[model samples]
Target: MKNLKGKVALVTGATRGIGKGIAIGLGEAGATVYITGRTLEPSDENISGTLLETQQAVIDAGGVCIPVQVDHSDDEQVRLLFERIETEQKGQLDILVNNVFSGVKEIGNAFGQPFWKHDPSLWDAINNVGLRSHYIASVYAARLMNKRQQGLICTISSWGGLSYIFGAAYGVGKAACDRLASDMAVELKPDNITSVSLWPGIVGTEEMFRFSEKWKTEDEKEPQNSTMRDYYNWETPLFTGRVIAALADQQNTMNLTGKVQIIAELAQRYNIVDENGNRPVSLRSLRFIVPSAIPALKKYPWLIPDLKIPWFVLQWTMLQSPKI
Candidate 1:
C-alpha cells in the first residue's frame, strides 16, 4: 500500500458509495480517514451512507476511520467539522477529498427547459452542495495544508463540466467547481499543496441499485438485473478509489495539479479494477450512453433518452442510481 501510515485524510460523503470507497481505500493504505456526511442515521435520505459502516470497513481492512457528521451546506457546520478534525486528529491532515453532494430534487427533471422555468430551490441546492461546499472545505483545508507545506486536495468533478449539458444552474455549478480546483491549485502551488479535479467514470452505486429495482417493478420488460456482460462494462467506485490511492502515492504528484483528469484514463495508467478484479471501462468506450434516470426509468426503454446537455448531471444521476 501507499505509505500513508501516519497521515490523516478527510473524505466528504464518506458514508457510502464513491466517498465510502475512497475512504476505505485510504484506510487500507494505512491512513487515518475522517468520514463526513449530513447525518449518521439511514432515515436521512439525503445522507444514505453510514459512518459506522465506513469505519468498520476501514478497520476490517486494517486501518482507522473516524465518522463525523456535518452538513457542508451550512458554513458553521463546515467550520465546526474542521475544528473537530484539528482538535481530535491535530495537524496531520495529508489528503482531503471533497465528494459531498445532495441534488436529489433534480432526479427526474427535463434538462431542456430554460433556467427561468426551473425550480429556484433546486438551483440553490445544487450550488450549495456542488460548488459552495467545496470552496468552504477547500479554504479550511488549504489553511491547514499551507502550514505543513505539503498536501493533496482532490475534488471530484464530472465530464459534464467540460461539455454543455442542460439547465444553467447544474452546468454552471460543475463548471465553477472545476475552476475552483484549478484556481486553488494555482494559488496553492507555491505552498506545495496539490489541488486538482478528478472524475469517476460511471459509478454503479447503491442509489443506482435502488433506482434499478424500482424501475424493474414499473416495467417488466426492462432488465433490472445486470448480466455478467453489463457488470464488466460500467465504472465501479472502487476503480476510482484505487486510482486515488495511486495518486496519493505519486512521486511528482504536483504535475497533475489544476488538470481535470478523466477516471477512465487514470484507471488505465494505474490498472485499477473493480472488486471482481476486472477492469471497469467507460460507457463511451463500451459504446453505450446512460440517461438521467428515475427509479422506474430502467424498466422502460422510453426513459433512456439521451441526456447530453450537462454531462455531469447525467453522470451524477446515473452514478447515484442503486447499483446491484
Candidate 2:
C-alpha cells in the first residue's frame, strides 16, 4: 500500500479487536491517527484492551497517536469528538473508520438462538452503538470531508449483513451498516468522498481466539460438534486495515463508492496478507454465499420465493434462507 504520510485519520472503537488493528496499520503507514474508545487506561480490566494500549501500538508502529475516551453510544461525546478533531486538525480529516460495535458481549453463545429467546434489550445493544453511532459519526465526517472535497468513510461490516450468520439483531445491525455506506456514498459522491462497507472473513482477534479455544475444548468431547476448524483460516484485523489504507490511497476510489467489498477479494487484488503472511479465504467461498442485490430485492420481494428450512438442513448445506 502507498504511504499515508501526513494524513489524518479517526478510528472509533480502537480499544481492541479490528479497530485497534486498523489504527496500528494506519499509524505504521505514517498517518497521524486519533483513536477513540470508552476505555481510557490500559489498566481497565473490563475489556481486553484500552485506548491507551492502541495509542501506544500506533506510536510504536511509527505514527503519531492521539487517544480519546469517547463512548460512541453518547451523542454528546461523539459530537464533541468531531469538534476536537476539527479544531485540532484544522478541518483536514482524510479517513474516518466507523468501527465501533457493541452488544456482542450480551449475545454470548446465542449465535443460533431464536430471536424471541434472546433478551429484547439486545436490539438496543446492537443498533444503538453499531448502526446509530455509525450514522452520527458519518454526519460529522461528511462535514469535514466536504471541506476538503476528498475523504474515505469505511464501515467495518460483516458477512452476516449479506447472510444470516449470527442471530437477528447482529444481522440487522450489519445490514444497516452496509446500507449506511451505500446511501452515504450517494450524497458524498459530489464532494469526492467515498463511503464503503467492508466485510472481513472470520478475523482472529483476541476475543475470537477465546471463543475458538472454548469451542476447541468442546470439540474434544464431540468431534463433529465444534466449528473451531474454520477459524484457523481466519484473517488478521490488520489485513482489513491494509485494504482500507490502500483504498484511501487509490485515485479511482470514487468508482468503488457505495459498494460492499469483501476483504479477502480486496486482499487478493492488492496482494495483501495477514500477520502470518497467508491469504485468507473469503466467507463466500467457504459457505457458497453470494452477495445479494439487497436494496433492489427489498423493493421487489416478489422476485424470489421464501422457504422455511429446518435448522439442521440449513447448517448441513450452508445455504442461507431468504430474508423475506
Candidate 3:
C-alpha cells in the first residue's frame, strides 16, 4: 500500500457504521482523519460507537484523528465545517468521503406502502440527508480540491439505489448520488480530483445486526440453530474502511477516477477480506440477477430486488463497461 503519512481526510457521518470504519482505516494508514457526525452523544440507549471512538481507534492504530459534530442537512453547518477545514488545515485536503445518513426507520417502513400513501416528510428527510448532503459536500470538496489540483472524493451509496429496494425514496436518493459522483468525475477529472461513488456490500454493522435479529422468526428458530447469520457477518464496516485506506494509498488513484465503485471490487483489487481475513462474498453481480428475477424475487419475498438485470450478466457487464 502507498503511504499517505501527510495526507488529510474528511469523512462525514464518521461517528458510526461504515463511515467510522473508513475513517479509522484511513487513519491507520497515517492520514489525518476528520470525523463528523450529527449527534455527539445520546443520553439514552446503547450507542456504543461515537466519533470519539473513531478518533481513539485512529490513535491506537498510530494515526491522527479529529472529531467534529455537524449536521450535513444544514447548509450553513456544512459550510462552516468546510471552512474550518480550510482554515485549520490550511486548505489542504486529500480524501473526502461523504457517508452521512439518517431517517432509516421512516424509509424502511415505507417499503410496502403504496406511492400515494408515502409521507412527504419521510422523503424530505431521506433526500436531505442522503442526496443533498452528498451533493453539497461534494461541491465544497471539489472547490477545495480543484484549487489544490488533486484529491479523491468518494460518495457512499448502496446497491438498493439502482433499483427497487423496498424503500423507493432511500434507494432513489442513493441512485442519484451515484450519478452525482459520475458527473463530478467529469468535471473534476481535469483538475486531478477524482470523484467516485461506492457501496459497501452487505455490511454487518450494529444496526444490521439488530435488523437481522428482527428479520428472523421466533417460530422458525433457524437463526438459533443455523449459522446463516454468520454469512452476513462475514464483512463489517471495517472491511470497507481498510479498502478506503488502500485507495488513499494508491499511487495512481487518478487512473480510476470518476466511477461508481463497489466494495467487492476494491477488496478484490487489494485483496481485502472480512475480519477473519477470508474473502467475503460480494453482491456486485446481483444487479444483473435482480432485474431478471424481479418477478420471482418479489413474488418469492426475498430481500428487495434492487436491479433489473441478471446477477451474472450484471457483473460481467459492469466489468466490460467503459470507465471514464
Candidate 3 lDDT by residue in tens digits, 1-324 = 327788999999887788888887787778889988876765587666777777887798778998888888789999999899999999998999998888666755664466568757877877888688888998888888888999999898887665554366776788788898888888888898888788787677777666556545333443321222433324678788888878877777777777778787788788777666765545644432342234334233246433334556765664474110
Overall local distance difference test of candidate 1: 0.72
Winner by lDDT between candidate 3 and candidate 2:
2
Instruction: Judging by TM-score against the true structure, name the best candidate.
Output: 2
TM-score comparison, 1 vs 2, better candidate: 2
Where model 3 places Cα greater than 4 Å from the true spot, the runs are: 42-48, 218-233, 285-312, 315-324
Give the per-residue lDDT digits (tens) of candidate 1, residues 85-157.
Answer: 8888776678999888776446435333577886688687777886888889999998888888989999988
lDDT scores of the candidates, listed in order? 0.72, 0.79, 0.74
RMSD of 2: 8.5
Task: Return the TM-score for each candidate structure.
Answer: 0.78, 0.84, 0.82
Q: Across residues 1-324, which tens digit of lDDT does each residue of candidate 2 receive?
A: 328988999999988899999998888878889999988885636667899999888887788899999999889999999999999999899999999987667666565468898778888977888889999999999999898999999998986775665678888899999999999999999999999999987788887776666556552433222335444346788888787777777777987899988888788777777777877656444221221322223334344443333445644454555431
Worst 10 residues of 1 by lDDT: 286-295
Mind sharing the TM-score for model 3? Answer: 0.82
